[model samples]
Target: MEYLKVEEGDQREPVSPTGQFLNSEALSLCILGVLELGVPISIDESHMDSLVKDVFLPTNPRFSSIMVEDENGEKLWKRVKVKIKDHIKTPTFPSGLSPKIYDKYIDDYISDIATEKLPVTRPLWQIHLINYPTSNSNAASSMIFKIHHSIGDGFSLIGVLLSCLQRADDPSLPLTFPSVPLSSTNKDSNGLFKKVSRIFSVVTNTVSDFYTSIVWSSLLEDDMSPIRSGVAGVEFRPFSVATVTFSLDHIKQIKSNIGAKTVRVQAKQIQLHWCCSTRGNFAVMFPIKEMIKLDSKTPWGNYFAFLHVPLPKLTDDDSTSYSNPLEFVWKTREIINAKKSSLGVYLTGRLLQVLKILRGPEAAARYIHGTIKNVSMGITNLMGPVEPMTLADHPVTGLYFMSVGAPHSLVTTIMSYNGQLRIAIGAEKGLIDAQKLKSCIEDAFQTILKAACDDDT
Candidate 1:
């Protein structure tokens, strides 16, 4: 790792290994997070200018910088003068349009921008404002933020956004995240034999999983199904984004009845069937949780890695598993627990670092592209503030995000905000019906909720 020297009034920082991989030419990914406002509002370009210059830019220097190669040929962030107007987009829609018409137009606009690559000459981020009443939000306006993955992971970017937002109810009070407990209980009291057995299981599972990841990236690929296109450069294709909302109360009931540990357990259980049902391997992106918990002084960059948690397929012969919601939860829990016990996820991160040093960033990036493309889909979850927050004084009604340019037919992003869970599904246009997928997911949630209620009764 090398850092460029900082002179008086000059700012430059070396790009981390993980950042290099994400921003590489072969695999450039962007995070598209949308903020739905409670009231219709117009964008005051000058006020937004102040917000960006005074508040947002101060949160992270990378927000006002561009990625460039230093004299040593190592990529680094170079601070540059930012024209706030260049980064802010105000999209105009036809006037006197019905709510339904406006909704469709908004969706089309999002899909059109989702597949675009941020310009490297300037900062790799932009904010698009749609100030119109829509049936979907029942609100007057929404804001879509497009930030390059190279700048930071989803969590880091969320933190920066939080700094710019204040509690809608009380601006003086700080926002808080929901407390999710660990699913696994203490097992240190187990007997020596039991401990040894666990160790053996960990080693066995880790080796098997790491090997499977290699094959998935190299020789094997997910089979084409209703949810997967199995086509190269699928990320560049147009994608339709649809969301399904779930009540936190219902999620808690299911967790209590099923003895599940976290909200993700419920989410993954529902997503498992809808995303894929093929014999080929599927992988989900689990962040390196420990790396993401940074102090205030920590610089922002890509700080998380993907865990290739192998997804199981549902075949016609496995009718029992599909029919019994309780049994499905239990099976999903078992798989998640096993993956947690293994070290394959951490080791995979190390392998990428080694590849970066031994080969180069391009080699590592292509490897990442292959690993991501071979999988049927990817899923990510981020917890939002418990209380309502305001962005530039506008009341935020809801929040959700979708990843673009990932080379996968399906990408699911889950966000929990204000006692509700929003699961945004990004599927390739024409290849996968986004609404049908949402229906299946919603049905799955209801089935699980009913089963949990029955079990309680």
Candidate 2:
């Protein structure tokens, strides 16, 4: 195996083996974050270069360099002088463009560019800076990053991207937790029979999980939901992104209504799909703790295995109000807890390892191609700065991002900044309107909120 620092260019290797199977030219993973900075960039060539060389490149090395072709599969990033003008673009909007029109332009722009391949010959990323006068007296601005999926996975990309940001309040502080404090459970005393029972319970759970992962999951076709059918046909299609915002208070409001007083970041997905059957046909959750642990020195790069779960679809029924959501939240908690107690994750990891050795990269890659085509959708939520962040001395008031490519009709990216949760849905336009899904999310939250408000009344 070959190695390279994330900034040093091993974009398509060990960090993410799936990169080898993916389309380098046609499909790309974009980290398009919209920055609503109280301050806007004063576009000038030198300043842009300084921003790139000083602020961006060092933060995520994959940005300034390109990969050199290698045999025996040892990859590395080689640095080239990145021209500021070539990478950063400032596009002017038509005169008298309203904020509403500007908003429309953004949606259209993201859709149009979703399938547009990055220039593979150069470094695999670019940034778009938009600061235009709108119908409102106040002008708006955003910074967009378009990058190849091969470069890094969500976990790595988010860390480095946030590293590039400065706290709007305190530049000296780190964007993420300077150091996350970890907790471990202490062993409790129990009788000898209880200990034996505990061991027996562990063994039985492992056997059951193995049976389900290999037998039940492999044999039974995925169940149909709002997105894909149980036996959904896989196809290569263009994808689009719809960024929607929800209030943080509303999310908590809904959670509290479900009789669960405590909520964690990872549990929100359960809240969305608890009562529904959610399937991950093509997309499976990958366990990456082996490589990217809480204390791993290298924090950037891909490290995941695949697992699938079903989520309940949302509805427009006003009569049911809280019942459905309440059911979902509790069910999600139970299902996710059961999954945690199983050996399915361990089994899948070993299975993929065996596949890689027995079948080789081509065969393994084919499985990814098949799975993504079959499942065609994945959602990942990354929490952003609870406090406002800035870029190049400009205060960023808002931000959201998502990606689109083959075998994926809908890829949802959830991000929260300050007190706002932005649910960005990237999907195939022919199959569904991205806005329709956004409306569903908004409606689901509204009903949950109403339920909570009614309880107060």
* Most lDDT-accurate candidate: 1
Residue by residue across 60-138, what tens digits does model 1's lDDT show? 8888888877656788888989988889888988898987788778888898888777777788899898888776556
Q: How high is each candidate's TM-score?
A: 0.93, 0.77
Q: lDDT of candidate 1?
A: 0.79
The TM-score of predicted model 1 comes to 0.93
Q: Residue 360: error of model 1 in Å? A: 0.4
| Candidate 2 weakest lDDT stretch, 10 residues | 287-296
- Candidate 2 Cα misplacement greater than 4 A, ranges: 1-30, 73-76, 133-139, 176-226, 229-238, 253-298, 312-324, 452-457
Candidate-wise lDDT, in order: 0.79, 0.58
lDDT of 1 at 86: 87
